[model samples]
Target: MKSSKPIAGRYLGYREADRAAPYARFFNPELAPLAPHVCAALDRGGVPDILLPDIDQATTNLFGGEAVLEDGFVLTSDGGMRVSVRSAMPSVTPAMVDWWFGWHGDAASKYKLWHPQAHVHVGWRETPPAGASGRVLYVGQTSIVDEYIGSDLIRGAIRFVPPATLGFTDKSLDDDQQATIICAQIGLGDAPIDIGYLAHHVRAVPGGSEMRSRFWMGGRHVAGRNLIGGMAAVVAKRVLSVTESDARALLVHCAQEMPHLASFLPELFGEFKDAE
Candidate 1:
């Protein structure tokens, strides 16, 4: 097997701002295949897990487990075998999510992918615009429009976000510098996107008190109640019946569980939200 050092470097490159292109970035160079093996082990009726130390050693954590390598071991428990890796687990992207569930066996097909569909931020611009007018632009996923046209019977009716409303820049960066790079790896970057705080709508006043950006994932960002927050948003849609505060709570929890799920949470959740 390839050494973990090279793999870690690859990860860093993928997470960087400049190389963080959707579908173009690396998802799981060495660990993706393990998903199927782990799933197969779990089918035997025990908790199964995989632990990756850096990019090299992979530890198999199981309910009634065994040692897989010198640097790795499996932990077995009643709830399930806790798979702990000395190294950090890569964040799940849309493509990775699909692969994990798709190959996990027959039981995984019903599982729903989860992540924040849309994120919105609101705050005041204490400083003036860097250039001309403050920009407001939207990034959209092609699938969204395709699905819209497919179900709505609308042709040439699709709307596009003007460049003025969105900030479009291409730059390469390291994982420490940008998290969006990770999002692009697994294909979630293509979501219907809209960024920047709006000044005035049809009837809304031009207020500068709050500068915000909202995120919409399309379906649920979470799978079910069991997996709340990002996961729920990925798989299910937000319910009007639920209060915004509660919905946010779910998001907070999701961020806590999967720090790499999205890149902007550091700004959204404050400094602590940024995890290695």
Candidate 2:
């Protein structure tokens, strides 16, 4: 290599002496000849591991070195490892790394635009038409009233449903009886189902008044605008993580009470046939 300046000449001058020493030892005179060039290379952009001193001692203790040096290459106690100085760069902003690892990117991305679809209960002031139970399955658009109901459920839209009244005497609405009633309501319908209803919450939001109230059933929740979708999404994610095919197949079973949705389950989940 051509010498760039007096600094490079110094390394070239010792080239012959460094050549005489063992290549593996740090003090090898032959290799010492290239130390300056190595330093220069590191200044430009090189792995500091090469420039680390006392290979024998530093290798044993990455952190146990001359007390004078606050930071430089790191050596493990066993003397078998060496690390570059770049590892310290993370101290500048720890949160950046934390955010990258901590955020649920995959889950958030799936439902940010719309909550995941999950099952929901719908009740009529009057009983669903006799033998018309299958039509009860429906999918609805996202709405705050639905979301609010999903949160606590007691003070929200569910109150108008039978599960809130006939099913539960506690008035809390979370009682087992109420939940069973709700589950039964979900069972009444099938997939690819749509229904219309008056939206009580939309009028409060600007431009919401113009939007008609309707529900569509297939993917998940009956209420579109509520947290119910989020809850269902979480469950689905968990199930899919373990067994994609099994999860998709089990979703088909969700339509037991609602045969309409179940009838089309084969089509909706057919794509996952090879998930295993």
Best by lDDT: 2
Clashes of each: 48, 35
Note the Cα lDDT for every prediction shown. 0.21, 0.22
- Tell me the lDDT of model 2 at 89: 17
- Once fitted onto the true fold, the runs of candidate 2 whose alpha carbons sit more than 4 angstroms away are 1-81, 87-92, 104-276
Look at candidate 1 and tell me the lDDT of residue 260.
32
**What value of lDDT does candidate 1 attain over all alpha carbons?**
0.21
Off by over 4 Å in 1: 1-165, 168-170, 173-244, 256-276
RMSD of candidate 1 to the truth, in angstroms, is 21.0
User: Could you tell me the TM-score of candidate 2?
Assistant: 0.14
- Give the per-residue lDDT digits (tens) of candidate 2, residues 27-55: 21121122232234334431243344432
TM-score per candidate? 0.19, 0.14
